[model samples]
Target: MGKPMVLFLCTGNSARSQMAEAFLRQHAGNKYDAHSAGLNPQGVHPLTIQVMKETGIDISGHQSKSLNQYLGKTSPKWVIFGCEKAEESCPHVWPFSLQSESWNLEDPVDFTGDELEQLMKFRFVRDQIEARILDWITENRIDSETEN
Candidate 1:
């Protein structure tokens, strides 16, 4: 059997959800299978790749996916909504026996600013997602000693 799966959901698979997926995979790849998708699928944002690369985790190859792809498939152990839009829009009754939670993160892509300011916003959100994933791993006791 493989590690249990955890899916992160968001309005767009471009930033927050993608960051969560990468961070979780980096921190606990041996304990959980991290996946992410959006309700309205949009391609992964360039800023997402740039910010993640700064942290030494390259997400350049990651692709945005839709929630529909997993509808009839094996259910994930945990379904985490990375933003309010996803949590509010998601079905109230999930088909799988899974735990769900909302993180209510701001969308970095929605920010309006200069190039440097925009990059900073992306970095901030990226760091927050990484911290949250690390916290989740520790709180869940999901084998924190795993290597990348």
Candidate 2:
């Protein structure tokens, strides 16, 4: 199968970016490969883990990565900015990617509410990203099965 790639970037990989990473990786599966990085690295958030666990996706091993690590380290077909902070703070020269998009999503870290409310937002964002990514994949790529 051909490699289809995507990157999710944010100020901190703890919440928004990580959730996007975990969600896309899980939902996209073999259709696309996804990764997340932060402008300034920080450990993954506990709430991020808690929220993802509800959907049976484990992100416990996902490390908060600095954008520097990915700057010249990997080639992406797509690069996505998960928050406005990442877009504004991104390096002067973006590492080349075939497709780039910014979702400008809200960071759930500042979300103050009961546990249920926060989880609901997490799930909502996760599902939204999955839908968007899958739509992009479908529109831009042809599945291996259809190549013949």
Candidate 3:
């Protein structure tokens, strides 16, 4: 058996995709491997780091990346679209090995104003995404037969 591969995607690869990547990695343990990318890469957002660290998930080392980087790579078993733009921009050329889903997360990059408000929203979205991933993983709970 092999590790299940999961890919999280977004337009900017800065916030939502990054969060999904961390959540899956932390929650899935050794049962899976995960990565994240975007249609148009930008540096990882600073706030993304702050909020995840609140829950002790350090994503500060993650850098934003483009989807083209994975074009020729092996397709993942699970591909999750974490942003609207990435959902719209995903190429239809992926091989049949992929099972995909979209969370349609609101990009926190658009969030502005007070620092307190921003942190609140960031944590809110992060927790929501984390809960969703936890539910999905639990619903598909793996047995020993599914282990590598």
Least accurate 10 contiguous residues by lDDT in model 3: 139-148
lDDT of 1 by residue, 2-43 (tens): 677888999989999999999998988878899999999889
Q: Candidate 3: count the clashes.
A: 0
Question: Judged by lDDT relative to the true structure, which candidate is superior, 2 or 3?
Answer: 3
Instruction: Supply the global lDDT for candidate 3.
Output: 0.82
TM-score of each: 0.92, 0.82, 0.91
C-alpha RMSD in Å of predicted model 3 compared with the true structure:
1.8
Which stretches of model 2 miss by more than 4 angstroms? 143-148
- lDDT tens digits, residue span 99-143, model 3: 778788888888886988888888888998899889878865664
The most accurate candidate by TM-score is 1
Ranking by lDDT: 1, 3, 2
Q: Assess candidate 1 and give its lDDT.
A: 0.86
Candidates 1 and 2 compared: the better one by lDDT is 1
lDDT (CA) per prediction:
0.86, 0.76, 0.82
